[model samples]
Target: MTVATRLQSMQPTDIGVPGPTPGDMARAFRSVRRDPLTFLEQVTAHYGDRVSFPVPGAPALLVNDPDEVRHVLQVSARNWNKKTVQYGALARVTGQGLLASAEPSWIEHRRTAAPAFHHQRLEAVSDEVRAAADTALAAGLAGLVPGTGRVVDVAALTHRVGLDAVGRALFSADLTGHAQQLLDATSDAAELVVRLGRSVMPTARWAPSPTNVRLRLTRRRLDAITAQLVAERRSHGRAGSGAAYGDDLLGLLLDSGLTDVEVRDELVTMVIAGHETVAAALTWTLMLLAEHPDAQERARAELAGLPAPVSMLDHRDRLPWTRAVIDEALRLYPPAWAISRRSIGPDSLGGTDVPEGTLAIISPWVVHRRADLWPDPLAFRPERFLDPGAGRSGYLPFGLGPRLCIGREFAIGEMAVVLDRLLTTHRVAVPDGWRRPRPQAQVAVHPEGGMPLLLTRLRAERRD
Candidate 1:
């Protein structure tokens, strides 16, 4: 059978049980303003694996069990659609992009975009990724006095790196000028999405509410920027082979057999999904490496062994320890922590009855850190990923099934290049009393105040 068909065929187990009432779910949503993770944990703890929560006028399911998550996200995915509560705002900003579209449209977009992110295509862009990382690293470490200790916001640095990588790899442009604005707009959009999650009713859009205003403004700003980029690429024409600038992902998409509106939607989706998640992933990875000296040392050793003039793309796989570090970090702090789907029909999952229109929330945060699947769930252990059999069902940083991130390979490739380069070029250390920064769930989970790290240049390495 075809992979998509096989995914559709897998059925959920009939394990229906009594769950938290709609009122309880609403109360939890209110509490999420104070702490989202805690609120989700409370629901899971009180209601077991599957719990029903009232969202606006509709009921939703919060599924924490791994098998059930698999079934919802992978198996029986045909019966599920992106919950409007979560994606409606996204659609406003991104239109029918891969992240916002469902069913046939999403499948078509995925198929068309798949070739742009193919392994060979990404490999071709490796140098661009490295150049971006190097630029960010140099700028971040610049103007620091010797032995004075440079306190760099690793999250901001990674954001810049991600933006640079995406711009160079996709559009052949430098995005530094628009970085802060894009970040702010993306953050606002994410907040608006979370707020709308509580009041799932479509009335909010027509009510002239503050949320609606914010949503419209954010969408306008983001689209203006995206449109400008698209226009510039179109005007420039494709760069010749062996030139510094060539027809990349953005160029390919512009040439894709789709309307301009469709291309714009896809571009916006790529900007948000491509840059934000990788930045968050890199930030978290650096924070973990800072805490675990032995792991840092091992990663450095792996980098040291690489041939001179190494880049993130060239020797990513060669450094297993570095890859493991990234894997472990993703397990603990997935940027795309929560995904929601609505049931198209009544179904059972993890022995629970799920009614039609029920919002099914699948959280990688809960599953990846489940004690049953991961020993010492809170610990930063990269070794777990080294073992092929360890926590297969529970680990899903990029997600699963047909809707899995198309940029998965590109993100990994970019990350490996950045991490390898950073480890080899400098030694990163956090402040003595610096606690693990709580992730702020914006478009992606980012360190609340940006991840601060002490970046020390390796004595043998000269600034490029």
Candidate 2:
């Protein structure tokens, strides 16, 4: 018998993971969509970890239990494919890149992209990264009315910096000019994707809805950017040799024998994934640091002893506190708040049988906040991560399983370098009377709007 035939035959009976009916689940879906981060907290609190929302298309199994998470994400990962709603919707923009691809293709893409992010290659990329960070610093620190106590939109600056770094890493180009369009367009696409993903009512992209129109236009603009870069790289970046395209993400994708459309899609994925997620992560970290001045001072003190701007290439090993700050921030506000998978065949989760095609949601946001996982899970404690051996089954900032973010080390390293520089140079604090921004779930758990902060240049005396 064929593998597919055997797997289909192995399908289990209907699971007893109790949840409300489709009608009630739709109401729950709407409530969570309103404020997903908070709604998830509320649901997990009242209903316990095995919360299921039985919507029309597929019933979702919301799991905060560690064993279930490990099973779905690791042990039975082959049966749990990325054909779920979130990945399907994201494939509209990213087009089967690492995160969205399934089976052999995903494995292939991951293999091709692995070497570029390997420690040695990253070490080689460090010089370019340092230069990129300098460019980003210029963009971030520019127009800051330093002595006059100007209110800086900290999140905006982080996006700019992240954009520049990813741009350099991708194609050795400065992408700040395309930053706003990329950010806004990504948000628009994500919002529409969520609507299509969750609603019992199906919406087609070909339909001429206003939001659909915007999505199309945004995609075309994004395609134009990727096309231009791909053209430049293929034309002048080695010609017939197929050697190297400046050792960036685009270069690696090009060398992998992917077609033009395939290359374009991966580029879109890299730009969108590489830029904004790190931006959101760093912005939240800085905000949290500002809220706790003591942590900020500790991170700054850690950085004081290390080399100023160059933290990559083995230099980052010294900045544990700085790394911890980013880690803790990621724990509290994981960029990818929810990871969904569809069971291709029979599977078991947290001791319950899962039927074919069930939607299983592993929420990093909810899992990170589990009171049983960490002491005072709600508090900002970077020191918790400082310990090498901590309760880790519940701590999934990037994710778990083979599908864990391939760029985790790169993103964290970039954040480490950027945060070290920012803390060394400034005293960051939230603006007076500014309320905490509500966490919204789209592609990632990003702040609903711009995060405003007051940044003062730290003087020599302020170091102590």
Candidate 3:
């Protein structure tokens, strides 16, 4: 049957909105647990833009209408706070850092952290990103013969580049020594967060279940890393005074008068959230490029026109197509796939009244795929972004408004450097009938298995 026919067949929800009945939801429980993204897509197609979810005490609504999403996330943001199960689960690892904080204190935290991402600092970060990407690419491609290509797990390499970039640019430290431990700990924490978020009846944090025990161990590992970062800085007598400390984000936080505990929270937040998201974005970009060699070649052509000894920061104005490719990739696979907010006060979204304490779930994965907003939304066409007049009303890869990610510019720049270098140095391709990896959501939406692609190294002259 058609969407209109399906809508007509289903009765309106208790709040007079379109959605599945309790029985329908109960029947789809397995699908929801297996892949919430696909389950949400199926429901939104049937029910319409604003779908209400049945919950006993909490009134839950999935706001997919761009305008309504704006109302909840941007226009009337203060009315919707991040006190939902999503953020609550994340806070187990990040504490009250900016990523999960809902209190007014986050305002000060944002202000204090803003300078670390200023234009000048980002220019400096560009150098570090280029270095990190080059180092990672060199090591990862060391074994490949000159004329042949090998299957490489691009996801792992990008994660290394992202972590090293975050360490050097943000903290003025090296994280390679702790790379394996850090990656494992963050992975465990992300899986645990997803488990808690999806649990119908979440176990208390204090419980000694296997999940909780794993959670505690993961937190402790992360805390120890944070402590090491701080201790290393203090060893150089940079912990006490702003002038004595270096000018990276770590020093800035130390000088901002935050307690040692607050510093640890912010440090861990950046170390975990910052690198993982960038890595996911780059990994998806590479996969898309591999699938669309024409787009990859076009991006390489754009990069080829740049002057010799190119500086990504200084030559950014000449790389529109390169930037557009990254934009389209983000549109397809936004790292922060789902965003949740709880209403502190009653609000109306898309003409539907959202009662106080209602939960608003906004999935970029859903919104970015809306056919009404994007022309042929499922197709991978980076040219769509080339149109200067293209509207962003339905696009939100890095979120919207005040709580927008402060490191937006940094992340984009990091991806650009890696893409430019990789496209210039090697050819990215997949085997015949190669299927895209299934998207599995943990902390970020990542390919179920790592993204493996063939990388054929280009000659030295070709890179120039």
Q: Residue by residue across 205-301, what tens digits does model 3's lDDT show?
A: 8999999999999999999998999888878884444464667889888878889889988988888788889999999999999999999999887
Worst 10 residues of 2 by lDDT: 3-12
Q: After superposition, how far is residue 269 of candidate 1 from its true place, in Å?
A: 0.7
Per-candidate TM vs. native? 0.89, 0.91, 0.94
lDDT of 1 by residue, 1-464 (tens): 54234323433333345465444444454457656776777777777777755333345667888888888889988888885656766776778899988646788777777777776777777778888898887788876544445778898899889988988887777787888898788767767766665443444466788888888899899889988987876677656653322356676676666777888889888888888899999999998888888999998888778765444455345767777787898899999878888888988776656678777888787787788899999999999988868898888888888788888878877888888778776788988678878777655777887888988766545434
Winner of 1 and 2 under lDDT:
1
Q: Cα miss at 177, model 2 (Å)? A: 4.0
Candidate 3, which segments miss by more than 4 Å at Cα?
1-13, 238-244, 308-316, 461-464
Report lDDT (CA) for all predictions: 0.76, 0.75, 0.84
TM-score-better candidate, 2 vs 3: 3
Candidate 2 lDDT (Cα, whole model)? 0.75
Tens digit of lDDT per residue, candidate 2, span 166-229? Answer: 8776567777677677777766766766666554444676899876687688788778878988
The count of backbone overlaps in candidate 1 is 7
